[model samples]
Target: MLQIFSVTFPFFALVLCGYLAARRRMLPLEAIPGLNGFVLFFALPCMLYRFGASTPIAQLLDYSVFLVWMFCGLVMVGFTIAVTLNDRIRWNDASFGALVAAFPNTGFMGVPLLVALLGPLAAAPIIVGMLVDMVITTSLCIALSRLDGADKHGMAVALKNALRGMLTNPMPWAILLGGLASYVQLELPGPVHKTVGLLADAASPVALFTIGAVLARSQILTVESKHAPIPLRDYVPVAVFKLLLHPLLVLLVGVGAVQLGVPLSRFALTVMVLAAALPSASNVSLLAERFGADNGRIARIILVSTAVAFLSFSGAVGLMT
Candidate 1:
């Protein structure tokens, strides 16, 4: 209990501090992009590079864990799509809604928090989960979203765009470079290593704070907007799936995988479960807005699930510990 809090408290406390600062306008909203830029472009990549550089390539290439995580994500996406379709939601909106339900905040929140709780080695599973989300889950959602409209893009094009998006994302590149260094046994010069180490050290705290600040900004926007109040029914299902069902499905799938002789480590299993329990990815709302889906509903889902994740995530970590 206290032990678990000791481990998990600082992570959420940083988030709380950031949220309060932003909510009170203590931190200027304009500064957020710079802060995010530092994390995404520099600090986080360095941290992940360090992890990948040091870890064995075989451990990083564990397909069993990837498969299990992807299976659970696909299941959630399918279930959400079916439920939304039953409600007569447009296919595009339904696909995005399903995505909101399935995709966890693995990059910003999960990576730092998991590494904090489970150590740098935990990055392996986190990265695997991110790949699953980026490649399989997101591609499928995008394909389904394209199905309803006059976009006329074939599944091949949709998948290609998704792959291109994944390649453009710096995280994967950092991971790949790190893995290459590790595989080749190339040593970074002392000065460069030290610089990367410095940036890597900054990744966790800054990233966590950025998440809190973003959440606060979202809350502020929701309050000031003139849009009609979204029905609880509209976002609640997505919230439930994001916070509860997704993790549950992952856990079940992981257990079954272990029974079938998958070599998932205890730490990796714990990391996967915790990652699944994270809030919905903030970008899902952005994607919804871009694709002309129900962005408002998706935004509300992100806000509510994130607001509730503190307790849910704490409970998850505590239980696993």
Candidate 2:
């Protein structure tokens, strides 16, 4: 466990560094979005593209891994909603809360961190999981968020909006282009490849830092005196679901797949489990804010899960390794 902590501490420490930087005005609050934009648009897409282009097409499109992870995500969305829904908590809150529980921080944190711990092969499962969350889990949750809304189209409108968001996102397109490049045995010009390589290399540190800064910005924005003090019930349950339940479901389902002769590699299974074990994606709060959900509660859940993940995620890695 101590050894595992040695591996994990720097990652979490970077997160803390971002938090403190934004909190202290070292990185101005206004600049957080720009930093996040650079990461989302340029750094992360290039990183994913490189991974997708380099990985074998078969593994890149590993349907079994996709199905197992997707099933677990589906279960998480329903289970979390079942437990957390109430008079005070409606569809939007529960649905987004469910999203946090199911969608790990794979892009920003999981890919690089898990690869460091597990090696290069870990990228495939992590990337597949990232795609699953971004393409399907997130879209479904967003649609669900509007199922009870007064908008005449309700879920249909939300679904269209989700598809629009997915289309506009560069990450998936990068993955697609990379896959096509891999399929055609295409390579970029030396200078262009080097440029993408540089951006890919920048993805890890900048992304992790951006996550912390985003968290700090969320914390700062939600600290208004007018808002009611948060209770444990509002955020802790969802945090527990994200940090514990999500990964556990992945592990159990993965093992079942193996026992059923699904040919899922143990290493891939481990990667998927750890990927699921990742803290809630930091960006979910932004979605909550955009969709008019309770951003404070969402941010609190992210902060709690992330803080605890350092210990919980490291311990899981120690045991699994």
Tell me the lDDT of model 1 at 165.
74
Instruction: Tell me the spans in candidate 1 whose CA falls farther than 4 Å from its real position.
Output: 86-88, 150-161, 222-225
Q: Tens digits of per-residue lDDT for model 2 on 1-321?
A: 787888889999989999999999999999999999999999999999998888888888898899999999999999999998898889998999999999999999998899889888888888888889999999999988987683466777778888998999999899888888888888999999999999999999899899999998988888843667878998999999998999889999999999998989999998988888889999899888878788889999999999999989998898778
Please report the candidate that would top TM-score against the real structure: 2
* Cα TM-score of candidate 1: 0.90
Q: What TM-score, over all chains together, does every model reach? A: 0.90, 0.97
lDDT of each: 0.82, 0.90
Clashes of each: 0, 0
